[model samples]
Target chain A: MATLNLSAVTKSFGATTVLHGIDLNVADGEMIVIVGASGCGKSTLLRIVAGLETPTTGHVAIGGREVTRLEPADRDIAMVFQNYALYPHMTVAQNMAYGLKIRGTPKEEIARRVDETAGLLGIGPLLGRKPRELSGGQRQRVAMGRAIIREPKLFLFDEPLSNLDAKLRVQMRGEIRRLQQRLGVTSLYVTHDQVEAMTLGDRLVVMHRGRAAQVASPMEVWARPADTYVAGFIGSPAMNLLAGTLAEDGAAVQLRAGPLLRFTDGPRAGGEGRPLTIGIRPEHMLRDGDAIVTVALDLVEPLGSETVLHGTLASGEVLTARLPGMVPAVGSNMPLAIPAEALHVFDAETGRRLDA
Target chain B: MQDAVLARQAMARQRRGRWLAHAALALGVLIFAFPIWITLVGSTHDAATIGRGDVPLLPGGHGLENFSTALGEGGGRMHTTPAAGMLLNSAIMALLIAGGKIAISLLSAYAVVFFRFPLRMAAFWTIFITLMLPVEVRIIPTYQVIVNLDLFNSFTGLTLPLIASATATLLFRQFFLTIPDEYVEAAQLDGAGPLRFFRDILLPLSVTNIAAMGVILFIYGWNQYLWPLLIINDRSMETIVVGLAKMIGSGDTQNEWNTIMATAVLAMTPPVLVVVLLQRWFIKGLTETEK
Candidate 1:
């Protein structure tokens, strides 16, 4: 219902900086997901926004009200933790009612909201049962219901679906997305799973170490990752990054493995013989194209409809190609084509994108 | 014929082993129960019968008379009030001790585990060190403090010093540490400040431990003799345990053995009842296993 702004929010635990001056502006009713590997400080940034953690510097504002120093309850935000964190002794209804009850809502209002939320979550039958009696998925729903009943200005989810089994996790992920859309509440969800990030967020913040590496829509981040780190992080079979150099005319990159890959996206700000790291996604490695790259086969994975091939380049780096169905078992020298537009180039040393 | 004979011999040996095990178990049970059985029989008899050194093995005709007298007139010691007063005093003391210790310990433990305050560990260790110095170790100084405060012969003197031990606090601290950090965060988001969290979440979750600790502290408070003996001199304020011991009266030769035995039986009943009554909750282990 309201915009959230984090202006240079930094957090440090003792001497170790966990989140380094993170700045994000989430539009009203937008669900922005922060995704990263473990220790990347995505969770810390989320916590700082939640008011469970205090940022070492900068400000957090929700609905135009500065809440950097406010308590989570005072910040008007609800968070669903990874463990659900339902009060174990309380029944599902009581768990949902706790926040409103604490806020001194009228008895009937609290009861009505709790009942309505339970029904929305399809957990009405579980109202009287304590959290201990509920299944894992059921507990997760109750945890969500606990947050939704508050009807807070914003919702924060810290990998809420991580605890469920893979199948359940997918189901819950879709449900969470659906609920958030239906409610149209501003939400920030943090997770390490790229698929969840891609599917759930209006925009994805791909974090690396203590900083946001790339913040863009899912498809934008996929098609044009801001850096080599994000490119490697987003795809299923990660983008194959090879050490290459700009061609003498600056129109293409010459691979150390002796393949001349042309650039079709745009001309980059790099000179001839400029050392660069060139990336090509697995799915975009085409079998029919004008540009050809010869590779030595290392391994192959047959995943039903499509077969993914892993090959060793001449420079002794791994290259992957995802091609559709029944690839004839090619010998040592496997000839493959990579379309030019799918190529991503970054400065070799800094790892920053050169195709800006 | 030889095979059949061997099988029969083996069966006989197994029977003998079973008989021996049962006999040993019965002997162990008897050894533990003998004193209680004798006390029960002794409590039922007249003073003349027990005083002649012929303790009866069965209930005597004086059972009702002995109980009624004990209940109505106490042990007949000088200025001795009825067993009812002493029983009430004991009940008050025990409940207060258990309840006071639990309340204090729970609060202190919550503070130590959840909050980050200056000198927190110092306070915890200070409390923890009290475990080394039980009331029995520092009785005289404690007694002096009670006397200086004009708390003598009062319930305050009897229960206050006993409540200062750190076992309950340390026990609760350990239990509090096992609670997940997420719950604390969840409560904070739920707008429950420390006190509310303590009342609603921590206390309810600790029901079994509190019950278990209650059983222990009640017995500890009930069986107290030395501390109460030194503090309360008023016959009206006497606990049943201490009063039962007082009936022997500093080498009084005319002590009524039947009344004393009846009072001993009375002293044993409340603590046994408390344990029996709270036993269900006492045995339910900590952690709801719901997660």
Candidate 2:
């Protein structure tokens, strides 16, 4: 296991910059998931760390050794590609043993390791089959097995489950997490799917426009995102953002969305008469009469375990409330409540969290 | 009843179309086969019998005499005419040229497709430009270069100049381009260097292209005439094409139609065998390329 550190890493293709200065320090044996939207350079960052792509500026160190100029083979790292880039000509066993064979490992030892890794992956019976003979999930497992057999210092997964179907993606995600835990190898995973980042990361790095927005544990990022982008990108169904102005009333500061629903979060010294965006997660909103404003329902989506109610406030601002059960139907009026502490205040112009 | 009649009319039209297609194909095959048939029949007739212009509609029983005369039965008369050495010389030169061309094309194509260096694009275009320039245009200059290298009238002169054909390089480059980049990336991650990557991954994947190019190169080298004739002036160094020329050059009164036809038949053997043997890969190469 090794810790990967990137210091002031920047990448540019011709004149267009893909990655701005990125600084991240992954702890030894830590599984850090880098989450971002497409073109956010998450995959490029992983490739840079894997030594597949060289940074236009800055350095990459694995286990305290600078490897910015090293080729991928010299980096002592293994990566599982999204397409499961297994050699089409090789059997499952040969695919797993390929790295060792290239390294000049003994044939018997290669076979033994292949058998052992295949057994661990529960693909022991498929040793002689080529990659085309295996299903999508099986090919994914083989790709993982190939990496595990190498026992490299770091494991890089570039959206490994993105090609699989939803059910298979979930299953393979669990399998990967379990395997990583069992081996305790340092890992870096890049994905656009926030759920994979949330569930798989020991620490999550939320990237925006090629810069790291926040780097913390999954819960920390969920509860306290660094900015409006991180807050909106991290959670499912997304957080609801309403544009308003922060107004001072006595000793408390209140957010006025449209003079109907007001959110007061203690007293603020500087945020007065300034444009602000108030953020609240859908799960945090409740269907209670204790709220400051009553809302009229516009749509309801029942998702078995939890129901999502989409409605408009008296101010005509759209809001969503994820409730525990089926709530009011469309066109019905209901009162909505949000805890005062759950409100996330952000600068309207900058999109930076005001309370952060 | 009206619908049935219309259906029947359509069926009859389809049958007529099929008959016309068969007829066209038969006429095309006959046009192609007529020359070979004439050559075979001509080989069995005595010179006087052929000159009489009443060539038989069946075998004339002069096949053995023509075969023996072409195989050197005429002693000093036909035996020392370079026809016999032409077969062995052409076989050696064609095999060497085919082997060298395949080797060079594969190496050049792999380097062009997989590696990056300065002037790579220039080199690719330079080689590709030669495809548009026929060998006939460069025969004199190529002959001078070969002679300057002291390869004149030698096997090296005959084979080396024809070793670097653009057709093979183009075919191989297109084939290599179809292989996904993932394989190269995967091999790189597995500790394979460029040489090993080319050998283990790219070469194995390009078997069909190599075989197809090898067949084409063999035929092109085997059928070469003007350059080999211009370069190799020695009687012993003459290829089958040059040898066929000498047969037509001997005094018209002494012309041996039977032996000339026998030599023609022998000359066609190598290219025909090459195509027949590698037809499977040739067909696969053509079909796979369309995808």
Candidate 3:
């Protein structure tokens, strides 16, 4: 149980810089998930914390001890890899006991801990089996058991549940969240999946191109993304971003798709005719007779509880709407209103949020 | 009715092809086994019968006598050592060479694959390039080095020069590369240093490769004739292959063909036993490198 701090951590491979100075502070016993697309340096930041990779220039401290230059073993950290990375030649018990055995724990004590950890993981019957004999889910449990038996101050997970099927990923996600809370170990988890980030972390660090775009609670990030990149990344069906310009003295935005949507919160501090990007989430698009914009449907996906309509506006911009229950069939025009409170305005050129 | 006729034709054609394949394989087996059969038959015969150019195709009644004489006195030749002593020497040399080569190759391969140091690739290429210079190619320089070291007529001289095998090292290097990098990271987190990793993880994983390489290197050591002939002048240090060659003595005197044949059979037995014992593991190691 330790607080982790990474200050201005940067990494580069030869000429290409991967992580461009990321700084984050994780509270003790809190799980902070770093989520991003591939090649976005989330894994690199986690590895830097793990002492598996050295940052080009930065410092990492765990429990008030500087571990930037320490080896992973000396850093008092355990990592669960995506592939489980269980030593195939070892039985499950041996895998779980390996760290303690290497630390010269007594044989009896090692046995006792292996039994205890196996019981905790519900893998007692599997302790005698080799990794190859276990299913994918079983191997995942053993990997977690191996990390847990060490009782390290910090835990690092590199997309640990990404290898499982969808149903198992969900199940293991819940289990990992419960286990991390119960163990109360400070953890840094990296994943490309937004759902995992949303459900697993106490706070989420939505990364874009190596920098932390937003670091906040998941719901906070969802409701108020920091920029256009994060606004598009964290939600399913993605928030619809339309190109527009500030009009009526920055109190409203004039859409190229022939609608004037006013900012409800307050007037953004931008000059008139300033280019802007307006964001509206799919679930927030409401059906109204006198709507702001009209969409001619091209694709309609109907679930039992909701319908996702993919269409294009008359002014030639694609929009998706997730409405409750089924809507009309494809090729019909659906006039949807964008609620004023749901508007997310950003600078068109810089992609930064335009806050009032 | 037409479909049944076509099926019958197909079955008959398959049977014919099988027969043809079996015939070809039988011919190959005969071609390979003929010399060995002749040696077996010749060992059972009297020397006088073979000397008269009337070597029999079938076995003779003097098989036990010939074997005992070959084992006890080694054909009464002047330079030839007894079969038992030569067998012991050959066994020791083969076991040492195989074990030493495996040990050295495994360590070198582990170093090249796992560690990052200055000139690592240079070291690997240096080891790899030695494969081009086999013992037969650089035998004279090797002999001079052994002689200068004063290792003449010693088992150390006979086996040590043959111990560092480039092929085995390369094979192990390729095998080690197939191991995932995650295992190394996982082991690092487990607090295992290089030596512990090698002992706990690498050595156990390489059991099949060791068995396979053991079979190959044992045969290579057992069949060595030129190196042993160059270094060993003492009768006690003579290996079986060299002893067998010396038993004939340049075709000058009436040789004890029966004894020589019996010794040849005895010389082949140990290598064959090693291969037979480890055949299953050898095949598995060669074909399947996956975890």
Most accurate candidate by DockQ: 3
The regions of model 2 sitting more than 4 angstroms off are A249-265, A292-300, A309-318, A327-336, B44-48, B55-65, B68-84, B289-291
List where candidate 1 sits over 4 angstroms from the true fold.
A288-298, A328-333, B1-24, B76-81, B249-255, B286-291
TM-score of 3: 0.98
TM-score of chain B of each: 0.91, 0.91, 0.95
CAPRI verdict (incorrect, acceptable, medium, high) for model 2: acceptable
- Which number leads on lDDT? 3
Kindly list the interface RMSD, in angstroms, of each predicted candidate in the order they appear.
1.3, 3.1, 1.0
lDDT of 2 at B235: 80
RMSD of 2: 2.9
Clashing pairs in 1: none
Poorest 10 consecutive residues of model 2 chain B by lDDT? B73-82
Please give the clash total of every predicted structure, in order. Answer: 0, 0, 0
- Cα error, residue A121 of model 3, in Å, equals 0.9
How do the residues A1-356 of candidate 1 rate in per-residue lDDT, one tens digit apiece?
A: 79999999899999999988889999999999999999999999989988999999999999999999998889999999999999988988889999999999999999889888988999999999998898889999999999999999999999998889999999999999999999999999999999999999999999999999999999999989999999999999999998989984778888887778777765667678889998889998988787777778867788989999988876888889999996756456788887878888999999998864
Q: Which is the better candidate, 1 or 3, if ranked by DockQ?
A: 3
Task: Name the best candidate (by TM-score).
Answer: 3
Interface RMSD of 2: 3.1
